[model samples]
Target: MYKFASTASIAAPSAQLTLSGSGVFIFQIGSALGTSLNSQIVLVNGALPQCVFWLIGSSAVLGSGCKFQGILMASASIGFMDGASLVGAAYAQNAAVTLINSVITVPPACNL
Candidate 1:
């Protein structure tokens, strides 16, 4: 049987970008931001759609992004910021996906 645990914070950001578009292209695209942090989600092994984690909660969207506009119809990892974007149903054998964002905001004290 599978167990539920803190299972490392994926630490990997699914998507990060400097906004630059219209409506959402203006303010949100210029400097708006949002984030997703899931806790104790489901993780499975073997086969596609292997891990089934649900969107527990998300930071409000301040941009005119594609929340209700329906994502670009597909089954892969859509990086459009839609609530339905797929990060992974990732297989165990596939190469690791590395996401490195240089603009990380560390707390002031952590700047030591």
Candidate 2:
């Protein structure tokens, strides 16, 4: 649904997808390999937790001090760098989940 080559930091607004914190954002790389996210803030504006980043046959990475919202699903692996935090959930289907000083919080149960 969303595609991105690389990004630094994201703090913008979207009219289609509405995130919870401020605005909605979707950053995705191609179907090649996984991508390493070196961002500080990754906020997806929504009322409930949604699958924000879904990688099939690839891996996902969150850099240090990164703050993210929404669910991240991958088929390979998911890595959280130092101090990276997630306000949603993460699933590395066929691989592993590595966290180094990173925190992953399960959001409130959606009632909808």
Candidate 3:
């Protein structure tokens, strides 16, 4: 269950995002310089395709049981926990990624 009030960019570098439990995931990306807030919300679903990578500016949060199939890029920081899994690389350009015993893998393509 994810809802977005502000404006931001929503891009799934490789895969698509799927919602669960009648929830909607809203992501508004590539807005004006400072007219909008760069924020994105994602809902967790077992039937959803794995996320390849996310290019975020401010912040990004993932549900507990969610799974990502690629890299995660953020300008500020990224937070995830409770059995969340990232199968690719994670790059916080100007911040850090917070995780709690989560799974992470760096794919070869990420190097390029």
Candidate 4:
């Protein structure tokens, strides 16, 4: 499990990120606490088409027009900006989920 007790963002325009297996990536709001500036996972190339993002923050924000794949689980609210799309599921445990012109497609249920 990867834990971050402060604000974190995957804002690298040219970076690749893949979270899989039983691993959990946790994020807790830091200096920018109590605002909409929670943890952010930006869209970028080179990322795996199928994975998971476990956000343990006050909130989770997806970049606009992002094409992301995986099961995104957040501890609080989840915001999907305009044009952002997800090829998986998203769960917000303790707050309302807001989406603006976003797409969410759940993969076909199957067992290996």
lDDT of each: 0.21, 0.58, 0.47, 0.57
Per-residue lDDT of model 3, residues 1-112, tens digit only: 2223443323342234444542222233331111112222334553222333445556655545556544556676676655656666666666778887677765454221
Candidate 1: clashing residue pairs, number: 3
Which is the better candidate, 1 or 3, if ranked by lDDT? 3
TM-score per candidate, chains pooled? 0.17, 0.61, 0.52, 0.61
In candidate 2, stretches whose alpha carbon ends up further than 4 angstroms from where it belongs are 1-38, 41-56
Measured by TM-score, the strongest candidate is: 4
* lDDT, residue 88, candidate 1: 31
Per-residue lDDT, model 3, residue 2, is 28
| Model 1, residue 109: C-alpha shift (Å) | 50
Output the lDDT of residue 27, model 4: 37
- Write candidate 1's Cα lDDT for 1-112 as tens digits: 1122322122224323222222211111112123343211221232112122222112122111211121112112212232222323211122221222211111111111
